[model samples]
Target: MPSPTLTRVRQAYARIEAVDRPEVWIGLRPQAEAEQEARAIDARVAAGEHLPLAGKLFAAKGNIDVAGLPTTAACPAYAYTPWEDAPVVARLRTAGALALGTTNLDQFATGLVGTRSPHGAVRNALDPTRISGGSSSGSAVAVALGIVDFALGTDTAGSGRVPAAFNGIVGLKPTRGLVPTTGVVPACASLDCVTVFARTLPEAEQALAFMASPSGRELPALPQRAPGPWRIAVPPRAQLGELDEGWAEAYEAAVERLAAAGAEIRHLDLTPFTDAAAMLYEGAFVAERYTAVGSFIDKLIAEGDTGLDPTVAGIITRARDIPAHQLYADQDRLAALRTRALTQLGDADALLLPTAPGHPTLAEVAADPLGANARLGRFTNSTNLFDLAAVAVPAGLTPAGLPFGVMLIGPAFTDERLARLARLLQPRLRLAVVGAHLSGQPLNPQLLSLGAEWERTTATAPVYRLHALSTAPPKPGLVHVGEGGAAVETEVWRLSAEGLGQLLAALPRPMVLGQVELADGTHAPGFLCEPDALPGTTDITAYGGWRAYLNH
Candidate 1:
């Protein structure tokens, strides 16, 4: 049986079709397609599947190939048919996830204002009058509305992170080349990265892990899964621009939550970061985007029937004129700016910044497309351009009900450390974890030991089983058996780096950390045993937790 949460997800997808918004999708999978996927996932689970995101439904940004689906890329004039799935899509498919369909994006991955698509603008789920930030517009909406557990998008310059924040979700932009762009359309081949959008951090992280390549996985061989009082950097008050008082308040609340949980938060001047952001478009990078689609875009324009997004066309038009010498000069400047930004980061565990400056309405976006869009990318555009890895976590909603998000950015390969910190900060966050650290048990303490704060106001989906393993000192293994497990009660927890290290070092042999899908239809790191440990061990799926099993 599908977990109630997954059931609800299915029902929500059904309802979403009634209020179909083509602006968010270029091509949506039919009911039969979704049903076919569900049956396959059920089969995997029935056979004791061990894949990440098993049974999860996700959508690919239209720029990616999904095997049998056309890559519209929000531009009908530039569609292509690929015989095979994109690398990331194939990975997700292999993990037993169902592809809901392909979503719309900013045409050619060119704009942040969602409206650049030929399909139409993707509206923010919370407030339809508002714009869903882009170029990964539709992917964010699908996740925010629960139409899919998570969605895939590509980010060359904040396309992934911006839309995520606008739609109240987590957007994770891994290190460049980490998720493989082999099957994905390129905006800037060297800079483009496939990203994940989801309602919760755990979901996004789970998708990221499934998609992460060893070559691009930048996590340190840390001590363990422990969160600590991390030294975090933030935008200096002076550098805070374009005020959204509500976002400011939520940002402060997020800071307070971290402080309450013992994190050392520091405010630092982000002047250098601002400078780097300017370099992305103002320097050589814009030319890179032009170079990426130069021939295709040029051919269309030459035919005089180029219906490219006007703004995208304008951006590309400018790229056509840059001299090679000027491009080299800009590249040299980017190097200096990168050094300065890193120096500002200066050994802090991670830099914390608003995922977007504030939310902009569709009206505001339509009126001032470029400015409104740049405001959203102020903190994010510099990431990939400077070779940084980042993870955005929901900070909570502002008093005005707008979602506030904060991101932890680190030098390449720091995703593991950042995830640890985001976990510890979850209470101050509205994010959920459907993984192994569900609280009020031994494993729960492992989360606490890793600096994970609990959100008492929340609960998980009850889709997993609690197994009492035969390991020393004992450990409760929560596995998503999608078969006969009861609704297991568990708490969601967040952690930081120092905390992650401690938990990892403390882990005993035979009990390793692996992915687990929680009752909430989300995945998290949980206690996993190498097959050798399960023999002769009693199957305690009836009891939701180790404590419950022992009590009986």
Candidate 2:
């Protein structure tokens, strides 16, 4: 009598063994261990416990420690067995997620290409010959190939997002320090962030929320979701980097789609962001990586057991010569650049960009590792450097049938907002609720059960009236009155089309879903009262909102 979730977990393990992709995992937990965890979760479920992530399968990048697993950071010589899981991993486990294994990464978590590992390069999930972007390489591929529901990856300079872009998954890189790095091997300690990769934005956001620090300090107020039309910033056409024909076409199509879906696309100068990205590797921040593992690398070199990836070794080794003064200078420069970048993001909801310039074949990376890797991080490196939250989602496939992705970037703590925006790029609808259904209201649970996420609270465009409808539970109705009406307060929520249908079917009499215009002049599906049925309703437009009417 195994639950369906347990059945899926078993099926996932079987698929993992059947696939037999050795390069995807550096170390795997025994199937017995996973089963035991799943059984425990089922027991908890039977006891009536609510688990947000009940029975979800997940994997962690090798650098993020798991209890009883060797944390190699993709370098066996530097591997260490940790007695406890990384804080982020522990959080997921507590929420009922089962870890399958530790996935491969670029050696020392230094390279963006997947090949910088002793375990072997992680091939693209879709086409093995192409590169799987790294240093979170295998974590992305695991989720991409359906081996896991979601996986943990760390982002320093694009490791989390780049791999997701290449593999056609949703990658969420939370603001720096939002997820603790206690048990993770550092690349650039100050810039590193624990990121999540999943098939959908909501799933990724759920994992991120569970992993975030419980203390409010690391978790900022979740961004209030803003209903469309979203003000999306983009780089000028001339500023866009050169891309292969297939990627260029796909990226352009994505932009066109966003515009068609009611987004106000604004082109801006991207030099400041790009300039900040260059500083991650070219500036003194590189010293942070050296500080984390330089000694171990030196020891390996001295013993002539230099089992490290040559490219990663070279990158870390060069940091030794960075004088203290140079590091200070770069820090100052970075601070100024951060200010400029934040200023540029002033009023825009989010910046939209190609996740990577193009997808490169494994042969391309082998021929020119540095160049190929650099190109892959073009839109990603600056995200951490500037302390921004980012979500990379699959846009569609290239003409060559390879995946193409786009990233939505926003200021720190905008993880929730970015997820909301990302959903617009998918199959969902924006719903406006005027009464009872607002957050914290008695009827709010119904919307939550329908997978509805509150976008924002706004008002009608000074052309609507509020009326307290005569009903047993007592709900308010939003009525349109053209030019003489006062704006009525409303909360906008998002839901899948199926959820909308269910909501419409369940709506009580006199209440129907219709177009309601917001103050911004954008129309969303909202509750409206049938004019003939308003005879018994009380005019409460003077109070402005349902909550206000109730309080008065």
Candidate 3:
């Protein structure tokens, strides 16, 4: 019988042949070599040695070095064979993960749209008509399609996360410097992070551990788990103006899901974050991109080679004109924005955001490459600038049947903490808050303190009457009426049983926790009032919800 490891390797090669998308990979490891490595792993396993990633197959982005493969960064004229694997790739191989090949990337790792390469655009795994978000496009698509267990891509802007979002997979952009970049081509050497794309968060986390340097940077120990009742910051609704038709709704749905998972929702102004994103290309950061390969590109231009992506060439060429003083000035401005953004996020466990503003189609990007690609990076570009760790996870499908994703971002070394929080984003028991515990309301912090997460804003089942009670700070009393009732808006939340018990123990008179029916025909434990209290209450159902009544 063939060795199990060798069998898996053969299967992977077979799948690659079936995928038939030449654009996704720039180079692939020879099948015989991979099978030989697999046999060695099987031999070790038979000898009682344990290899965690024994049968795993992975790919490296073209910009990253993989022994015997050319490091092209999608520029054929700039390609060169690397003698050794980058440290990250070397570590993964050491852990028994096989490198299948170097995947395609945006030339020089300059664009987010994934189309800036001589190799054809890497198509989306789900919708071929749409772009597979790029510079890390092929890495993400490979993982999404299960062609590999995991893949490596460098994130300078949103290269890592955008591709994951568009392709429906997990993208973990580790804290910059956590993974060594010794053998990888530089896009922005200062901000570049070796990112990992995997089908799931746990797998990505495991891969990241194998890739992280053990002693180079003395970093904080990753938290085993983030303590419950996490404070997850989100931007105000207005900040999401760039989201596509169904994307905003998709994001709101994701926010609701996070809340239902027991996170405290904190509204933060994203001006600082968005401003930092703009600085990546609009400021001196572009000069860093030039510093990476501008001279080589210039040499090619001098030699009359037109193979470089025109858009990428134009971007680097423009950076040649930025003065040294301007770079320093922009650096200072970035420092200020980073300080302000982090300050605004004070006390929050992590910031949750839509992975990308929207998913764009190939046609959309083709019509306006620069503008569409810039928009794709709107939410992702500032991560490295702020020195944060980010993990992008597939949220769900949009109304248009396209994939949507949300990212969990935290301080530079909070990778583990963000991972812990990401697990909560899955389905969980829900609770409804009709009044006092609504987000931004007076009593909302109480629920937050108890680790209750706000899920989504919804309404009752058009069979409840709302009233204003005579109390301190004022509270709304929801009463279920068999007939002649109105739908009262409510917020859904998730809380642990311990948290729910704590909340129940502190309830004031007449307010009780009971099953409340929602407009969507779902029922959840929610705030209700004893009917006896109606004698002294003033009916306020006409206003719809507590906030509306207060405003009136």
Please report how far candidate 3 places residue 20 from its true position, in Å: 1.2
Q: Could you arrange the candidates by TM-score from highest to lowest?
A: 3, 2, 1
Report the lDDT of model 1 for residue 323: 84
Ranking by lDDT: 3, 2, 1
Q: What is the lDDT of residue 458 in candidate 2?
A: 90
Evaluated at residue 219, the lDDT of candidate 2 is 56
lDDT of 3 at 257: 82
Model 1 lDDT, residue 26, Cα:
87
Clashes of 2: 1
Report how far off residue 424 is in candidate 1 (Å). Answer: 3.1
Stretches of candidate 1 exceeding 4 Å from the true structure: 1-12, 47-49, 215-228, 428-552
Cα lDDT of model 3 by residue, 73-154, tens digit: 9999988998999999999988888898999999989899888889999889888899998999889888877688899999
Per-model TM-score on C-alpha atoms: 0.75, 0.76, 0.77
- Predicted candidate 1 versus true structure: per-residue lDDT over 1-552, tens digit per residue: 665325544775775776577677888877766776676677667688776666578899999999888997777888888899988899888887878789988998887878898788898888888888889999999888767778999887788887877777778888776788888878888888899987666667888888877765455564342455687887766587866877777777777776776778876678777887877777767888777787778888888865788788878778888788987887788888888888887767788877887788888988887778777778888888888999887777766777777888888877777877776566432223323444544456666654567754333345555556655556665555555656655555555433443464456656666665554566555455565666676777666555566678
